[model samples]
Target: MNAYRAKPLRYPWPPVLYAAAMLAAVSLGRLAPISVAQSQGLIPWLAGGALIVVAVSLDIWAMKTLIERQTAVLPHRCSSHLVTCGPFRYTRNPTYLGYTIMMVGFGLIMLNPWFFILASASVALTTAFAIRNEELHLLSRFGFEFERYCRATSRWI
Candidate 1:
């Protein structure tokens, strides 16, 4: 008899992509600064701050849920089971969504157009490298349960 063992992910692409995008945005902004508006006021700061708070809240909720479920939070590690509670009930990729939202909030706060652009790129890269791979692993491991969850929940909100 052959026993099937799930293989772990090769790289933690979500955080890495987000970090790289942020670095690129900062570097590009420093080289040639692009402001959202010439006369930036309190509006941007308020909106950015609100978004940051929401993103942080969502991330914390998701992480807490993962911990409570006793599942692996790291991208490279294999999750023990399908998580469909708390934030997972809404979005399949809450952590990645939170990262994207935080990047957008930072873009607004810094008044840097590059951050916005790089944030989109980060999503694309993360989807291609991280999310897709994670989905495959989950489907292989959890099969029907994962499929049911995917059908019910959106990838990102």
Candidate 2:
């Protein structure tokens, strides 16, 4: 019998980390504001709005796919099945991608340089703390099927 179980992540949830990062960025920006542009223009508004929409749509699609497949949505839980349809076809980590995109969108909308800087840091932390363990667990559980999916799909898009 397989003895391995997907262990809960030692770190906080990715969303929490993202939120903290955003907060920190905002605080830092207020203390030392670095202007990206002279004015809050229409271009930033349109671009940011479009990005937010895409991020939300991707997240919903990914979550729905996971639910339909009867797999765990939270990273801490073990996946019951390998999901390869919907947004999963494009990115192995669609949810994380969504989070990152959302952060970027907010950064643009807020015109905060610190948001862009900390967004990169947030991705790095998430990858190190979350994705590494998830990949290992999925490999241990799903074996070659997960490997094939990894080969076919990008981690982020």
Candidate 3:
């Protein structure tokens, strides 16, 4: 094998599926025990929304810190420099973590357990795919440096 596989389909189906699952869970939860509406009208929603924003912003920060400076996949070849600092210190894929967190936060805000579960699944799947791609690229580009970094950092934190 080439250390990495071909890129999978880029459709947003995974995220969509997660969203659906979350909605279903939340709806069921609300129906079974207590509805979020009865508890607090707009409070949890606002908090959840804020959490989502924060999570997305963190991902953006990770993107800026790691990928933005190193690689240029837009114009031509996928030439990305190895990024191993800041958020990368804790987790190999902070951007993906942030993405997952953001989705999970949204699900929580909706008071939908299903959404949260879906978000979690999406994270797991995305991580599996992204790590494979990233590690291969890193191994090819940075060689020992990337491998060393990978050894040091956890994949998710």
Candidate 4:
């Protein structure tokens, strides 16, 4: 799908959907026991912080590369270049991966098992929608070169 030709909600809805779920969990989820919450302490905070940092950095890195490469970031826009450098070498969809990791990190921070459930839903939505559509678009646009990239990189790490 050429990104410019695609509508907003049709292409990038995961972030909004995840945010809604996160908000719902925060407001409606049963808080874990005080003991449980307390015990899930510094480590979770540290780890979650680390994951968020990584996630944001990966997104920055990938977006920078895409911009430098003169490639379109929008799913329905024309892709002028296929970026294989930086984080793209590792994951086909670093932006999507970043969002997934962010969900996990947010879950860790919240200490609510429901947040983890939200993260799982995030992953499932990401896979079923974002990645699937992007993969098909990339494959159709880039053809064999995209296939080689796919062969070399995992979808997510």
Candidate 5:
């Protein structure tokens, strides 16, 4: 059976789910982190800001591609087309990767080692929660074309 067909919980959406995971990470990180990237420094702020910018840029690019293709962006909906241009050319999931990158920036701003740990967990959860089903749907709808695209592109990078 395909992954999407075998799926159970599909609520909370990927973005919301990701945010909740990040928050959980921050809460745990506040308890006793091994080390902080920066207790007090301008570099931390600048680096966090830079990472956020990078994340936003990738997200925008991916969304633009979706709009151009007239494809549905939401996971629950079927896409009208398999977008292979722009950020999709590099990663099958630029939007999710962008969110993960933003979470990393958040961890940097918080200067918490635990947040990084949580971010890693979040990535795995995201892969299972969102990416797998999304891939399954794409595969079912587009068949071999989507498989070829998957072969050509990274899941995240």
Candidate 6:
């Protein structure tokens, strides 16, 4: 799995693709004949924003558990742990899970199908990329331990 090992990513592709899809969905929704009420401005937005924050907190907690479990820990960007506890036991990437939940919350706040679609796309793409990169790193680092974890826990929940 050396070929798939995590390395410097092609930066803009992931961000650009995700942004473009999100924007396009939003643009289409706006252009189409839909009577969207502009009145729902603050409350829903606040609620959704709160949800996003909670998700992020959960992610932080999960990551912390992984950090505690790993022999050598690093910062977020350089984390080398193959965490399989906490929320990670349910979904391989709780960080991504937080992002997904946040996106959904944002969609609810926006009350726009476009935002929802974008959130979905973002989750799907991020999950694919994360799994690929993380798998390679885990295979290289933890070997059988990582494999056992993978067998026990799902990639996503």
Report how far off residue 107 is in candidate 4 (Å): 1.6
Candidate 1 deviant stretches above 4 angstroms: 1-5
Tens-place lDDT digits, model 5, residues 16-127: 8778878787777767657643456677777888999999999999888898889887667766788999998898889888888888888777776666776788789889
Q: How would you encode candidate 4's per-residue C-alpha lDDT over 1-157 as one tens digit per residue?
A: 4652233225557667778877766765555432244544589888888999998998899889899999887654657677899899998888878877886787677676666677778788878876677777676677799899999999887
Whose TM-score is higher: candidate 2's or candidate 4's?
A: 2
**Cα lDDT, all candidates:** 0.85, 0.85, 0.63, 0.75, 0.79, 0.65
* Model 6 Cα lDDT, one tens digit per residue, 1-157: 3643443233424445555665666687779624556655588788788988987897788757876887222221334666776777787666666666766676667676666767777778765765566566667767898889888887767
Give the per-residue lDDT of model 3 (tens digit) for 1-157: 4433222223434445445655666676667644344436777688778888877787677767745567532211344566677687888777666667776677657665556666767777765654566567667767788789988998887
Question: What lDDT, from 0 to 1, does candidate 4 have?
Answer: 0.75
Least well predicted 10-residue stretch by lDDT in candidate 1? 1-10
Give TM-scores for every candidate, taking all chains together and pairing residue i with residue i.
0.92, 0.92, 0.68, 0.83, 0.87, 0.67
* Candidate 6 total steric clashes: 0
- lDDT, candidate 2, at 6: 57
RMSD of 6: 4.3
> Can you tell me which runs of candidate 2 are displaced by over 4 Å?
1-4, 8-12
- State candidate 6's TM-score: 0.67
Tens digit of per-residue lDDT, candidate 1, span 61-147? 999999999998988887897899999999998999999999999988888899899999888888887788788888888889889
The local distance difference test score of model 3 is 0.63
Candidate 6 CA-lDDT value? 0.65
Error of 6 at 74 (Å): 8.6
Question: Cα deviation of 25 in candidate 1 (Å)?
Answer: 0.5
Q: Report per-prediction Cα RMSD to one decimal.
A: 2.2, 1.9, 4.6, 3.2, 2.7, 4.3
Clashes of each: 0, 0, 5, 7, 0, 0
